[model samples]
Target: MQWKTDGPRSIPQAFPYQGSKRALVGQILSLFPTEQVPLLVEPFAGSAAISVAARMYGRAQDIQISDVNAPLMDLWRMIIDSPDDLLDSYTKMWHEQQQGENSLVEAKAYFMLKRREFNDTKDPAILLYLLARCVKAAVRYGKNGDFNQSADNRRMGARPANMQERIHGASRLMQGAKVTSGSYEDPLVNAPREAIVYMDPPYQGTTDVPDHRYLTGLRRDVFSETLQRAVDNQVSFIVSYDVVREDNKYGEPLADDLGLLHRNVVVGVSSQATLVGRKEMSIESLYISPALVQRLGGQDKIDDLIDVEPKTQDALF
Candidate 1:
């Protein structure tokens, strides 16, 4: 069907992220205001996929991305400010990967070595390589706030040519974006009047998963409070999550006071879930601000706003 980012360098969505909205970039973007969108703010910018795509597709000319994971933010800043240097270091290390006999063991050992390098220097290249080599691109960390994910043998990380192109492609989209390292609340606190804020924070349903393991039980209340302020200021927002509780699944809905608009957004089967059993379907409710809703024609429900079909369930797989 010619979806964007289906292959290497196929779309402006350049970063290879774990749960990227790259494929759903179109669907997510369908909700953008037809009027001028001044800024695109993504607080939990895991891979900055949505932010970059929004800029590339003209949803917004400016972007601001932040994450509590400082090292992750460091990678984006490096890509934005010095793509060539970051790519050079990455290419050098990527070429150093082991080949032939016992390659898996050798490569895993080398990955840990580079991870240590990333920890010591906070080098963007090392982090990029680690993310590509780590299991399912998931970044797990210990209670000590250190990366704890082991290498995955099942995957062959992207080759250097593609990876280099990715860095450059992302750099192009980042030309006018602000990259920061701090809490998601910081971005919300400073959200502009005409900005569109999308929060894809750690999902409450997957606390056991590696990506959410470290961040769970930390920011629920604080996030709710900060969101309230954004609401008070009439800032636009689209939060991905819903209040749900099932057999073994549980999800949290947005704070009631904000009274944001919402619609179901079906996501693909989780890669992490696939490892444990058969693929499991997941769905999120995108809670949009009243201001954004009115901008989209003040409708109670828009066809593009809610996608419940299985067709969209694998957008990121």
Candidate 2:
């Protein structure tokens, strides 16, 4: 289906993922180069929401998706290259867990078995099932770098029919896209001049810490240096870093001397703050490279475009 800016809020998502950026795709796509670029690269491509949106909107002719998490990338590769096989495996596992009388207990057991298999053999389908049933669809890895998140137990993952549609939709949109498992550096540093590199790295607060959500922890200093290399190489890029809740910024801002322009796209109310009896708006900082800023009609012109809400959705999803 062709996605219009004013269409429904739900984008075609192969699987549920925490911090997927699916909600922000419209606003993010608005900032992409108006002319269709030859290629679009996503190094830290968790869910690859922006790349899917870019393809659907005809903003990119080719795409590259990479991540440090091999199993996650394997799942993405399956979604892109072999949707039917992946869905068949998921469907079988989804039905297998429904056989027992104690539904919840049986389902939890099924999830645990799949999680173990994913950690042991790194099966893409098992990983997909685990993410679908995991708590908050949040990815959590143990010190041994195994997927350790527990099952939600309340609902079965996406229905077979729904999963089928999402998998097919995402696969169709990303046909022929390159999928890889590697560090963010390869794509970021080697992006062609005609390519637009979109990065959503682990936030400063989450990185360089023990027992964090990500399997691989990134050092801020090292990440900054890599970004500098990209800038020095004249790569056109955009970064989705930390968020600002109310007037409080969550993480340290990127270095100012990197030759980039910064803007905050208001992402609506903070769920965390609202639960504590307070209403605070969350605004995400978007760092645009000098090349991209000029490509979009310089800083002043881009400011006017960024200030307006995306026509696709009335509020954050």
User: For this target, which candidate reaches the highest TM-score against the unseen true structure?
Assistant: 2
lDDT of 1 by residue, 53-148 (tens): 776766787888988888788888888898888878777777687764777777877888887776678767788888888886767776555677
lDDT of 2 by residue, 215-275 (tens): 7888878888998998888889999988765435678888998877887776556656787
Q: Could you tell me the lDDT of residue 32 within candidate 2?
A: 72
- The clash numbers for all candidates, in the given order, read 1, 0
Query: Model 1 clash pairs?
Result: 268-313
Q: Which ten residues in a row are the worst by lDDT in model 2?
A: 1-10
TM-score of 1: 0.84
